[model samples]
Target: MTASTEGATDTAATTDSGPTSLDTGSETGHQTTAGGDTDGSKPDLGAAPDEHCANPGPWPLPEAPLLELPRFVAHSYIDLDQIGWMTKFRSSVGHDYSDAFERCRSMKHYAYPIDEVDWGAVELYAPVAGEVIVVEQERYGSRVQLRSTLHPEIDFVLFHVDLMGPLAPGATIAAGELLGTHYGDQTYSDIAAATTVDGAWRLISWFELMTDDLLAVLQARGGISSPSDIIITQAERDAMALCCTNGQFDDPEELSDWVPLDAGNLAQPTRLGLATLDDDDGRLR
Candidate 1:
């Protein structure tokens, strides 16, 4: 449980020689200074303080899936903008470029907005039924990493973890399981990069939750109006079950066939294409 450190008042001697005059304000028990303007009244220097409140318990865990495993992971980024561009450019071009690039790729640093530290105050959950892969606690920040066999190609990383205590490495965890809470100088409320459409950085996990077809079902029914909504029809659920049971299709083009239900005459699935990630100089942007 987290504990709040509030309500404590410091007792400092205003004067060593004389009795200080006290002024009571409009509200009961709340006092202000006399001769002070109504617009700017000084707060009461002395008052019985309220006790600190205990932290609330953890949130209830989500139900597990019967067939396909769920994969959960939190995301965060360093405030690169705080550092000078020359430093960043030097780091990128220096002999340590390989190490820097590896770190950038592992954490997707380029995709992260330099202006803000994402996922600061929010709690992240496990994406899949996997064992804790890594746990490191040092001055930089605390980290709780997990891996699941459900998705071999993907490695779920939850960085910038702030926990009550150090989580043990190699611990077994289920989907929707509590990995850790947000910590350090980073937070979810940080302002997004200048180039981003929204001024606020997104605290959402990057891992994909549902297949493209299941997403199509939700889209056709207009069920997923918000990011929080996960409602789907029985047929959509059945399609997902078949996909997981039969194992994902080998051919990328044939993957659409795994979708069990068809929303006849529905609009074509939205296409999201990516352009080159390079500039005029043929270097990564």
Candidate 2:
């Protein structure tokens, strides 16, 4: 996750603590500001009430689809334990997986069953119309990690990838463009509090402002209705259900807050920093 410059200061006093002063002088010449005073004379910065600080206000939601249609369809969802809690909360709050699986099974569309691995070739495509933000070529022994800024308000993260070579940063890409391929042993692991059926590996990706629209879609589709319901498969549903039931998912509010706006529609690429996988080698365990 990238850092935001809005709240980057060190000594900005919050409502709960009042104005905080930073001493630039030596230890012997240290000075202090009273909790209420910005200057020595004024009782406060004339700052708004505490509620202003407590509730930053509702975040703006995107109108049109932030990401292009036919987005890179994952054969399965990333195991819940591999991502932040908010992602898990988003998946759980809007949908019931077990019930969805039963419904899918009744309809005989359960080709991708739990306890089985998706050995089928995994496809990779761009999530939005933007440039490559960052690409890490050597992180996972030929795997590449791509980060792109789809819009001024949204950042997209694609990992567990196998690319041809290093993609220059700032190279623009259209939505649904072939970004890379998926590579790894087609088995998952059962470590770090995440559940695994037999041995199917999971992948990790991050999204900023793009989630609200995705959530809205999932909600409209009855929250993970089935493996073939939309983007997720049956195995993915079972894995998330198990992870949520076992307390492996992160907090919902935090995840919801991290979503950014899908403005700008920028197409820039950045360098991949550290690659965070479920296990050390992008395997289950």
Among these predictions, the greatest TM-score belongs to 2
lDDT string for model 1 (162-196, tens) is: 66455675688776666554553321111111010
- In the order shown, what is each candidate's alpha-carbon RMSD? 25.3, 18.1
Q: Once superposed on the true structure, which residue ranges of model 2 sit more than 4 Å away at CA?
A: 1-120, 138-150, 164-166, 185-221, 225-285
lDDT of 1 at 71: 28
The parts of candidate 1 lying over 4 Å away from their true place are: 1-120, 138-140, 164-166, 187-285
lDDT score at residue 148, model 2, on the 0-100 scale? 34
Clash counts for the predictions, in order: 9, 23
lDDT of 2 by residue, 1-285 (tens): 221122111121223312111111001111224343455543433322111222221111111112232233321223221211112212322111111001101100101112233322344566556555445443432322223333322233444455545666667766667755544433211111111111111122232123455544433433342222222333453343212211112223122212111223122112111112222221111
lDDT (Cα) of model 2: 0.27
Q: Each prediction's TM-score against the native?
A: 0.30, 0.33
